[model samples]
Target: MDLNLRNAVITNVTGNTQDQLQDTIVDAIHSGEEKMLPGLGVLFEVIWQNADEQEKQEMLDTLENGLKKQ
Candidate 1:
């Protein structure tokens, strides 16, 4: 993911009402032990910074699709 896209996603999430998005992101980071793709790191950072239900779902779908390719 590009930084611009990541920012857009975060901005979208910030528009939502979820309050524990940050903690959930932190937990996800801590739980994942494998290394993430370089571009994907931008996505993770975006999720960590700001993520709500819709954004999270989109991010997760992107991630799952990426992993499925491997």
Candidate 2:
């Protein structure tokens, strides 16, 4: 079976409000389920695609700082 996970995740959250989207992200992170990682990756991909270079740098900095803590 072919599963287009990125498309599925995008479709599932397409019309969500800011609050709804925030809640979904928070819930997914808090759940810590491996299945949710791909959905998060898709969301991050959307963000990365839309971000400018400075925004991308900020995100990378945040990720680096986060990883340093672990």
Candidate 3:
């Protein structure tokens, strides 16, 4: 069996509206299930690929600030 999680995740959210996607993300985060991490990573991948340098830097800054709180 050849399973590609990234592809599956992408396919699952392909045409979702902004609200739908936001709900999915919020739910996955609130659920705190290990299974949802891969999907989140895939979503982040898509976001990273499309982001401008400044956007990426902003995300990094936010991530850094978040980790600092941990």
Candidate 4:
């Protein structure tokens, strides 16, 4: 079987509105299921690719802070 998880995840959310997207993300995180990680990762990859350097640094800083809390 051939699987393209990133494409699948992107396609699933392709036409979502901002509220819908937020709901999806919130629901996924609340579920605390390992299966949702790849979908979140694909979303993060899209954000990272589109983000400017300053935004990327902000994300990195937030991630670092989040890790510190764990």
What RMSD does each model have against the real structure? 13.0, 2.0, 2.1, 2.0
- Model 2 spans > 4 angstroms off: 1-3
| Highest lDDT scorer | 4
Output the worst ten-in-a-row residue range by lDDT, candidate 4.
Answer: 1-10
Q: 1-70 in candidate 4: lDDT tens per residue? A: 1249888999999999999999999999999999998899888988999999999999999999999999
Model 1 lDDT tens row, 1-70: 4667667555655655455565545655776754434324664675556887888888789889999999
Compute the lDDT for candidate 4.
0.93
Candidate 1: pairs in clash: none
> Which of candidates 2 and 3 reaches a greater lDDT?
2
| TM-score on alpha carbons, each prediction | 0.34, 0.93, 0.92, 0.93
Model 3 alpha-carbon miss at residue 26, Å? 0.5
lDDT of each: 0.62, 0.92, 0.91, 0.93
Q: lDDT per residue, candidate 2, 7-65, as tens digits? A: 89999999999999999999999999998888988999999999999999999999999
Best candidate (score: TM-score): 4
Candidate 3: residue pairs that collide: none
lDDT of 4 at 38: 86
